[model samples]
Structures are given as structure tokens and as C-alpha cells.
Target: MKPTLLAVAHGTRSAAGQRQIRDLVAAVARRRPELDVRLSYVDVQQPRIGDVVPAVRDAVVVPLLLSAGYHVRVDIANAVEGTGIPVTGTLGPDEVLLRSLTRNLPAADAVVLAAAGSSDPAWRESTHEMASKLQAHVAYASGSAPKVADVVADLRRRGARRIAIAAYLLADGLFYRTLHRAGADSVTPPLCLDPTVAGLVLRRYESALLTTAAGRL
Candidate 1:
């Protein structure tokens, strides 16, 4: 029997956000019906990772998160501890996500890559690297550095008109809504329901399975 592919995400209060995640999970299931794909959350929703991990006999936990921050390092690590189940890295800082971001982006004089920020320096750096690749200024909805609104205001001060915000989020929620009020002319949608994202989830699952197999040999 194949091990379960447990996709875990940071939960949101937004009903739309919840639906988007469910839809993304459905997309993954459609792509590979043979695999047992399940969904759980880390916060603000039911079926938290801690509760879900114990129920699965054998599985690989793939974080549906963009960066390796507090949730990935602490929350998930604590849940799967001593379970002998492998865990994959976060989904972003990858070319597949970059394509998704670029494809959704609209034309503007200035672009701000707005992310759900974290206190972890590594997370901040990883997000910065992605923003650098897109050639977009970096801002956060919360946690580290200059905020989304501040970046927009700064750009306006610098004579940039029609500034755009490229949402570096996996699903829409309060964070995405905040981007709309960030004083930008446009804000791209979150990276939800993108077929490429489904592909990336599969890749993470396969990669973890291979690594675990090699370790046993």
C-alpha cells in the first residue's frame, strides 16, 4: 500500500480561503487518484496537524506553505516527531511557483511581492530571494520589515505610478484582502488552484518517498 500524502496548510478564518485549499487538494487528488491525499491545518481551522498526524499509519507530510518559517520548523516538526514519517519542505522558493506568480501578475510601474512575513530570518531571506528573482520590492503583511502599505507609499513617493502587488500567498484570506487596501493600483491573486501547484505537491511527495527509501537501503 502507498503511504498517504498528507498535505498540511496554515489555516485561515476566511471561508473563501478554506475553499481554495480544499480545491487545491482536490486538484491533487484528481491528478493522482491512486494516492491517498489528505488535508489538515496548523491553525485557525479544524483537524490541526497534531490531531491528524496520529491517525495516519504511514504518510508523508508536505507543508502547503511558501517558506520554512515557524510553522514548518516548530509546529510541523513537533507533530511528526518520532513518527518515522518523512516531511517535505515548503512549496515556494521554487521555479514552478515563480511561473505561477509571473503568470498572474499584471503590468504596472512598480511591483511589490507581498508575503505573510515571519520572524525567522531564513524565512525572510527565502522570500527576499524570490522577490529578487521577480525584480519586485519585498513587503510583508505582518512580521518582518517594511509593510505592504509602506512599500506602496514609498514607491509613490519615488514617482512610481500604477504600482502593483504580487501576492506571495498560497490562498486568499485577511492577508490577501489587506493587499487590496495597500494603496497599489493592482494586486495579483494568490497561488491557489494552479495546476502547477498540484504538480509541485506531487514532486515533493515523490522526492520524500525516494529519500526515505534510500535511507532504509
Candidate 2:
């Protein structure tokens, strides 16, 4: 049986967000036709993690996220229920991701990282890592005090000649477009359904299965 590549996302009500997840799955399917490719959401969507894991009881689960958090460790945990399929890590701020951010953002400009803030400390730290990598001033919408606009204004106060807000996102969906039109200065193209990301997913799954196999010894 082929080990499945379950692409999980933090679900949203926006149809665009849901579509992004689907598109990512399609990209991965194209890159690695070997694995059983599928997608599931954490909330407000069908095929919850609980539902996706059982379907591929023998496949490794990989969160289509940039950082490890409750979804990767907790929600995904509950879904797998000790099925023995090694779970992979989140996909974000990777080498290509860093390149994407650097290439997208203008040099010498203050960057304001806009991410879907979370209550979890780990996730917050992960976001910080993503923001820091790009040499951008990090700001969160849900957890931190300053919104995207607030951060942009703060940069101006800091004597930034140009404030280029880079969306550290993986898709051209709501967060990307909404934050893109925020009138900061210029928001670069978001991480669309690209082959680089698909490769990351496939490699992560392979690593998970290898790790699971090693643990047996």
C-alpha cells in the first residue's frame, strides 16, 4: 500500500482559503504521484484531521504549515491516535521560503510580517522565526497588539524610507490578498501552488516514514 501524504491546513470560512488547500494538494499530487495525496482542515471544513488519518491508517501525516504547533502536535495527534505512522513537520520558512521572502521584499525596507496569530506560544515563536529570517519587523494580528497597519506606521516612525510588507504566506488567498491590498507600499506575490512547496511535502513524508522505521530498532 502507498503511504499517503495528508496535507492539513488550519481551516477558514473563506472559500478562497479552502481552495488554496485543495490547490496545494493538487500540486503535490502532480509532483509525487507515488503517494496517496489528500487534504484536510483543522476547523470549519470537511475531512477533519480525525477523519483524514484513519482513511490512511498506514500513511504518514504532514501538516501543510510553516511551523509546528497545536495542530501538528495536538490536533494531528488526536487524529492519528497512535497509528504508528510517523508524522512529518510543518512546511514554512524553508530554504526556498527564505529565498522567496528575500526576493519578494525590497532591500533596505522595513518588513512587517503578517500572519494568522495564534494563542499557542510555539506557533507564535515559529511565526517570529519566519519573520526574523526575512529581516522584517515581526507583528501578529491576533496575539500581538499591533496589526499590519500598526506595524507599517511603526516602521515609518522608525525612519524607514520604504516599508514593504511581505506576506509570509503559502497561498494567494484571503490573508495574502487582504494584507496585500493593505496599502503598505507593495506586497510581493504570495506562495502560490508552486513545485518547491510540493517537493517539501514529499520529502517531509519520506523523512517521517524513515524516522518511524528507525524507531523500531
Candidate 3:
């Protein structure tokens, strides 16, 4: 039997955010109907990682997070420890994500790649790397330096006539909403329900399964 694909996400209170996540998972399920795809959360919602992991006997935990921060390294790791259910890497710092961002990005003289920031340096570095790839400035909605609003203001001061914000988020939520008020001329929607996103999830799952099988051999 194929191992259950446990797609875990950072939950949100926004109804639209919730729907986007569900739709992303559903897209994955549709692509691979034989695989049992399940959805759960890391925070702010029901059937959290801790509760969901224990119930699945044979499964792989695929984090829906964009970066490897506390949630991926600490929260999800703690939940799946000793379960032998390997967890895949976060879904960012990849070409797939870059493609998703650019596809929806608005035209502008300057663009700020906005993310729901993290205290972890690794997470910050990953966001920066993605920003660099897009030739865009890096800004955080929370947690760390150079906030979205501040970046927008700075860009405007520096003579960027039309500034846009490329939201490096998984779904529409509090952070995405905040980007609008960041003083940018435009803000791209969050990354979810995109076919590339679903494809990336499957790639992570396949990569982890291969690694697990190789370890046994």
C-alpha cells in the first residue's frame, strides 16, 4: 500500500485561507487518486500535527510551509519523532515557487517579496535567497527586520514609481491582507491552489519515500 501523504499546513483563522489549503490538498489528491492524501495543521486550527500524526500508522508528513523555520525543524519534528514517518522539507527556495510567484506578480519598477517572517535565521536566509532570485527586496510581515510597509516606503523614497509586493505565502491570511496596506502600488496573491504547488508537494513526497527506501537498503 502507498503510504499516506499527510499534508500539514500552518493554519489560519481566515475562511478563504482555510479553503485555499483544502483546495491545494484536493488538487494533489486528484492528481494521484491512488494515494491517500490527508490534511492537518500546525497551528490555529483543528486536527493539528500532534493529533494527526499519531493516528496514521503508515504515512509521510509533507509540510505545506514555505520555509524551514520553527514549525518544520521543531514543531513538526517533535510531533513525528520516533514514529518512523519521515517528514519532507518545506516547499520553498525552489524554482516551482519562483514560477508561481512570477506568474501572479504585477508589473512594477520595484518588487518586494513579502513573507510571514520567522525568528529563525535559516528561515530568514531562505526568504532572502528567494528574493534575490526574483531581483526583489526582502520584507517580512512579522518576526524580523525590514517590514513590508517599511520596505515599500523606502522604495518609494528611492524613486521607485510603481512598487509591487510578491506575497511569499502559502495562502491568503492575515499576513497577505497586511501586504495591501504596506503602501505598495500592488500586491500579488498568496501561492496556493496553483498546479505547480500541488506538483511540488508530490515531488517532496516522492523524494522522501526514495530516501526512506534507500535507508532500509
TM-scores for all candidates?
0.97, 0.89, 0.97
User: Which residue pairs in model 1 clash with each other?
Assistant: none
> How do the residues 4-69 of candidate 1 rate in per-residue lDDT, one tens digit apiece?
999999999999999999999999999889888999988999899999898897799999999998
lDDT of prediction 2: 0.74
Clashes (backbone N, CA, C under 3 Å), per candidate, total: 0, 0, 0
Q: Pairing residues by index, what is the TM-score of model 3?
A: 0.97
- Model 2: per-residue lDDT, tens digit, 1-217? 7767777877777676667677778988987777788888787678788876766756777888877777877788888776876678788657777776667777656778787667778877888887777777776545555677778777777788787877777665556666755557777665644556677778888888788778888
Give me the runs in candidate 3 sitting further than 4 Å from their true place: none
lDDT of 3 by residue, 1-217 (tens): 6669999999999999999999999999999998989999989998998998877877999999989989988889999998889999889889999988898888899999999988898999899899999999999998788899999999899999999899999998899899989998888877885778999999999999899999999
Each candidate: what lDDT? 0.91, 0.74, 0.91
User: Which residue ranges in model 2 land beyond 4 Å of their true spot?
Assistant: 172-174
Off by over 4 Å in 1: none
